[model samples]
Target chain A: MALTASDVTIHFGGVVAVNGMALDVMPGEIVGLIGPNGAGKTTFINCLSGTYRPNTGTALWQGDELIGLSPSALLRKGVARTFQNVASLHDLTVLDIAKLGAGVRRDRRTGGHLLDFFRSDRALEELLMESILAPLELNDVAHKPIQTLSYGRRKAVDLARALAGDPQLLLLDEPVAGLTSHEGMAMAAAVRDVRDRHGCAVIMVEHKMDVVMSTCDRVAVMAAGSKIFEGRPAEVQADPEVRRVYLGEP
Target chain B: MSTRHIAIAIGVAVVMAVLAVVLGRYGAYLVNAVAIAAIGALSLNLLIGYCGQISFAQGALLGVGAYTAGNLGNAGLDGAVAILGAGVLGALVSALIGLPAMRLRGLYFAIATLAAQAILEYLFKILDPLTNGVSGLVIKPPSIFGIPMTSDESLVLPSLVLLVIAWLVVSRLLRTDLGRAFLVVRESEIVAKGMGIDVGHTKLWAFLIGGFIAGMAGALIGFANRLASPEAFTLDLSADYIAMIIIGGLGTWPGPIIGAAFVVLLPEVIQRVGEAAGISDILSALRELAFGLLIILFLIFEPRGLTALLSRIKLRRIGVVPPAGLRATGEGSQSPEGRSR
Candidate 1:
C-alpha cells in the first residue's frame, strides 16, 4: 500500500471542512474522489498533501505518518500534488516548471540539500524534455511562459510539473476542471499514462464524470465532508446515493 | 546559467575593465561609483526583485560590510581576506535579519526590516571601538596581492572584477533549483509550499547571498573612501538602492548596471549640461531637481525600467512583432536560450 488515510478531520472556525475522511490506495491504483462542490474533496487532499494539518487524522504513507509533515517533507516521501487552478507565474516557461518538478526528486535526503547548488540543470533538462514535456505535447512551447499559454495548455503544464517529480503517490486536485473537453480527455489520458509508467498510487479529485469513469480504477464519493460511498467506477455510477448527491439525481 | 551566459559575463567584465582604465581619474571615479552601485543594486535585485523580499535594510547591510572590512584591513589582513570576512559577516547578519521574515511577509516584513535598519544604525553609532562612533573608522589603505590601491584609478579594476563575479554568481544562481524556488516563492508562497519548497529556508538563502554581495560592495566603498561611518549607511542609502533596481527593471539582467549608471551619473550630467549652458550658478539646485523628476518620470512612464524601454524601441526599429510571452512580460532582448538571464 502507498497511502492509508483515516479519520482525517479539520475545521475552520464554525465549519468542518473535512471530517473523518478515510481513504486507501495500493501501488498503481487510481482513486477518484468525487462529490458535490462543498464536499471538502480538496480540503481532504490538503490534509494528505500537507497544505493543512487535520485536527484529527492518522495518514500513514509507506509506514510513516504524513499528517503533520510539511509539503516539502511529503514531497521527499514521493507525494506530490497539482493545483485546482494553475497560478500564472511571471517569466517561468513550461520546461522551467517541469525542471522544478524534477529538481524536487533529487537527493531526497533529510535536511536542505546543498548539493543542488553543485548540480548542473542542463544535465536534467534533456531528460525532462524527453520524458515529461514531449509526452505532454508541450515540446513546441517548451520555452514559452505559462502565463502566455491557453488555459488548457497551462493545466497540461501543471500536470507535467507534478509528473516530473517522479512521485510514488500523486494527488491531483481538479486537474482538468478548467480545460476544454478535448483537452480534458488528453489530460485524463496523461493521468492514466503516468500511472502505467510510474506504477504510482494516485488520488484524483475531479468534477468531470467521464474522466472519473474512464481514468479511475475505483471511485470514492463524499457528501458534507464524509465518505458517502466507495466502490469501482461502474458500481459508483450505479449507486443511488452517489447519483443523488453528485449527479443531481432526485 | 549555461556556459554561454558565463562567457557573456566574462566578456562584459572585460569590457568594463577596459572602460575603467581608458577613462582617466574623474571618469574612473564615475565608473567606480557606477560599478559599486551596480553590485549593491544586483544584491537588492536578488532580494527584492527575484525573491520578492522588500528590504529597507540594504544600507545597513552594506555598512556592516564596510565596517567588517575596515576593521579586518586595519588589523593587518590582506584586502582579499578583509572583503571575504565582510561577506561572511554580512551573510550572518543578513540571516539574523531574515529570522522575522520567516514569520512575517509583505508589508509587515518590510516594516520588520526597516526596524532592523534602525537597530543596526543605532549599533553603528554606539559601537565605539569598532565603528569609532560618529567620527567613523579611519584606516590606512588596504593592499591586494601586496599592492596598495591608493587612487580611484587603482580601485577601478578590482571593482569591475568584483561586479563581474557578483553578476556571474547571481546569473548562475537563478538557473539553480534553489533560485527557481525563489521565483515560485515570489509568485505565491502557498504554491511554493505545494510545489515542495521550504519557503523560509529559500528566503533566508536569498538574504544571506544578497547580504554577502552587498557586503562586498561595502568593502569596495570602505577601500575607496578609507572611512566607515554610521551616517554613510542611513535609510536614505537603502532607499537609493531600492530606486536603482526599480529603475533598472527589477529582475532583468543588466538592469542593475543601467539603473546604477543612471542614478550615479544623473547629477553629474545635469551639472555639466547646466555649466555648458552658462547656468553654473544654479547647477547644484537644478541637478537635484532634475534627478528627482527624471526618476519619477521613469517610474510613471517606464515602470519596467529602461531595459524594457530599450527592448520596445529595438522591436519597433526591427519592425517585427514580439512573441506573446515577451510582449506580455515586457522584458528586454532575451538570450538565445529563451530562459532567465
Candidate 2:
C-alpha cells in the first residue's frame, strides 16, 4: 500500500466528524469515497491531507508517519490536495497559480534553485500551459486573472495547480462537482490520465455518483462518521445497507 | 517584461534625469526628498500591498537604518559600508520583531506593529549614549573615490540611481517564485500552506525585505539632510507612508513612487499657492485639511487607487473589451460561490 490510514478519528464539540476511518490505497490507483450529507468522507480526506489533526490515528505514506505534519510539510513529502472551492486569488493569472504549484514540487531536477532568482520562469510557464492547462482547456484563459475566470474554469485551474506539483498521493475534493457535464467528463478523464502518467495514488471525495463509478477503481461508502461499506463500485452499488443509508432505496 | 512597460520606465528615467539637470538648488533638494520618500513607500508597499501584512513600524525601521548609517559614518566608515550595515541591522531587527507578531492576523498584526513603533521611539530617546539623548547626530556627506557629494545638486543623480536600482530589484523579485509565494500567503495562509508554501517563513521574508529597503531609504534620508534625528521619523511619518501607498495605489510597482512624490510635493505646492495668493498663514492650516480631504475623495471614488484609474483610462483609449467573467453582473464579480452543483 502506498498510503495506509488506520483508526483515523476526529471530533467537533460533541459530534464525531470521523470515527475509526481506515483506508488503504495502492500506487496508481483511484479510490472514490462517497457518502450522504454529514458523512465523514471529506473529513477523512482532510485528516489524510494535514488540514485537520485527528484526535487519534496514524496515516503512513511510503512508511513515513504523517501525523502532526503541516500541509506544506505534506506537500514536501509528495502529498498534495485540491480544495472543494477553488482559490481565486486577486491579481494572479491562471498561469501564475500553476507556477506557484510548480514552485512547491518536491522532485525538482535543477541543481541551482537559487539561480531562479535572476531569471523569469517563462519556460515553466510554457510547460504548465502545454501539459496541465491545455488538457483542461484552460490554455485560452491562462493569462487571465483567476478572479476573472468562469466558475468551471477556476475549478480547472485549481486542479491544474495540484497536478503541477506532481504529488505521489493526490487528494481531490469534488474535482468536478460544479463543472458542466462535458467539463465533468473531461475532468474525470484528466484525473485518470494524470494517474497513468505519474503512477500516483489518488483518493477522491465526490458526491457525483456517475463520475465516481466511471473513474474509481475501488469505492468506500460512509455514513454518519464511520465506514459502512467498502468494495468495488459495482459491489458498493449492490450492497443493501449502502442502498438503504446512502442510495435511499425503499 | 512588456515593451510598453520598458518604454514607460525608460521615458520616466529620462524625464527625471532631465529634471535633475535643469532644476535649481531648491528644486533639486525637493526632488531628492521625494526620491528618498519613494524608497520608504516602496518598502512599506512590499509588506502591506504585496504580502497583505499591515505594519505601523516602518518609520521606526527607517530610524534604525538612519541611526546605523549615522553611527557608522561618524566612526569613519565608508558610505557604502554604512548603508549596507543599516540594511543588515534592519533585517535582523525586523525578523526578530516579526517572528512573534506575524502569527497575528488583520488588525491584531497592526496593533502589534503599533506597539513596536512606540517601543522603538522610546528606545531612540532613552538610549542616550548612542543616539546622543535625542539631540540627534549629524551625518557627514558621503564620498565616492575622493569626490564629496555634499550639495543637493550633486546628490540628485546618485539618489535617482539608487531609486532606479531599488525599482529594478523589486520588479525582478516580483517575477520570481518568492514573489508569488508572498501573493499566495496574502490571499490565504490556509491555501498557501496547502500549496506547500511555508506561511510563517514567507511572512518573515516580507518583513526582512521590507525593513531592509526602509533602512536603505533612511540611510538616503540621512545622507540627503546630513542628519539622523528621531523627530524626523515619528508615527505621523509612518502614517504618511501608509497614505502614500493607499492614495497612489497598492500592489502596483509604480504606485509607491507616484504616491511618495504626491505626498512630498503636495505641501510645497500648497505653500507656493498660498504665497502667490498672499494668504500663507491660512494655507498652512489648510494643508492638513487638503491632505485629509484628498485621501477621503480617493477612497470614495477610486478605492483601487490611482493605478486603477490610470489603467481604466488606458484600457478605454485602447478600446479593449472587458473579459467575459468581469462582464457578469452583481455578486458574480466575486469568486464563484464555492457551492458544488
Instruction: For candidate 2, write residues A163-185 as lDDT tens digits.
Output: 88878999999899988988898
Score every model by TM-score. Answer: 0.94, 0.94
Q: Which regions of candidate 1 deviate over 4 angstroms?
A: A107-115, B2-4, B277-283, B286-295, B321-341
Candidate 2: segments with Cα more than 4 A from true spot? A106-114, B1-7, B318-341
Clash tally for model 2: 0
- For this target, which candidate reaches the highest lDDT against the unseen true structure? 1
TM-score of chain A of 2: 0.94
Error of 2 at B12 (Å): 2.1
Clashes of 1: 0
> Pairs clashing in candidate 2?
none
